[model samples]
Target: MCPVCGQEVESIYHALFKCVGAKNVWELWEECPMVIGTENMDFSNLALKMLECGTPRDMELLIVVAWAIWCSRNLRVFEMVCQGADQVWNHAISMLFDFREAVKFCGLGPLACEVRWKKPQVGVFKINTDGATEVDGRWSSIGVVIRDSRGEVAATLCRVLPGCFSVDETEALAIEARIILVRELDLHQVIVELDSLLVVHQILAKDFNGGLGHIVHGISGFLEGFHS
Candidate 1:
């Protein structure tokens, strides 16, 4: 039932590192490992061995390449789109290049580091949301937490959504879910927190595109109720 190679494979490791499509990518890679993992090995074990076998940079490259493979597989499944192994490898290389550049540049600035979450005002509540897709891309899980000024949990939730969703779409779903939950509770004022800057920007501008955009519009509509 695997989409990448048209195989009835159930192994995550096989899908990402051993299948014909995935193998094409690794073979195209300049430093592909001869012994990445066996087809039947668990993904966690393979990942642990990879971590133990390489430098931090090596680990980062492995992760990025693996992510590219997943994206490629998802595109093939959900969109009926296929990118050659060369293209997938190039995409990952580009991402890794951008990431290294960012890290290098960010290391120069003290203010470029991550910031911790702060509590909202006394009268307002804060809702934080996050979403992550599973390895096979068939499921996405979202987590939402609502906290009051005293840092007490007002409400918390977790759900597994079925489908292959883009990262943006998944993040937008989390925001939408959070908005709906808060609205249902009739909370007057609430501050939302999410890590997806793209979604945040799109929402702030009231601009959206495709499936993610549709979800954002729904979220924007819900915002109108809170102004009263």
Candidate 2:
């Protein structure tokens, strides 16, 4: 049962874009590029298309709207509280305004920051991974991209994991999977990157305590074989 509306099975796309609650919030931004009746597009494709076609301000608002939807979903799922569409819209707008103001105050120009890829050292490969979960905790996926020193593709892996209770567990599972891949390929010297700071810290700490402690412990053992 979906936590928000108790309808169809919850998925990342549905939770973020297509649910009744999500649709209401998007309709609030009728003038936004994403709400212009684009059909049959998944969340990842929609996000990429927005980045390709949207202006800087459009991009900012789009990100805020997505975040607002996620926050609203969390509130409903965790606290059994539902926020109105207007409230969600207002919150996203306020957040975007504050972000823009902060950028101006710092004299860093209009956009917040642009992220790009950097190559690893000559003998090392880099593995980047990220995890996503549905708001209702019904589904989850992990993505991994491996690149060599010359910035050439090595391998890519994306897999759906058994449902978990929290996103941190999903992230920890992703790191564990990436380590397995490294071991299978006999890649002794490598650098792993992930967006979850907590997972990185846990891996570096070499001590594990949490729902993901067992997974992190496995990763710690794998790390011991690599040359520092």
TM-score of each: 0.58, 0.52
Clashing pairs in 2: none
lDDT of 2 at 179: 86
Q: List runs of model 1 lying over 4 Å from the truth.
A: 1-70, 73-108
Q: How high is the CA lDDT of each candidate model?
A: 0.76, 0.76
State each model's C-alpha RMSD to the native: 10.0, 13.4
- Could you tell me the TM-score of candidate 2? 0.52
Q: Candidate 1's residue-wise lDDT over 1-228, tens digit each?
A: 566666756467878887888888887656655366444677667666777776677778888889998888877777676667765775576557656767786888887565678988898999999988643435678999999998899999999887645566678889898889998888989998876666777889998653456788899999888742
What is the lDDT for 198 in model 1? 61
Please, what are the lDDT tens digits per residue for candidate 2 over residues 139-228? 679999989999998999999886533456677788889989988999988998877555676789965764457888998988898884
Q: Which candidate is the best by TM-score?
A: 1
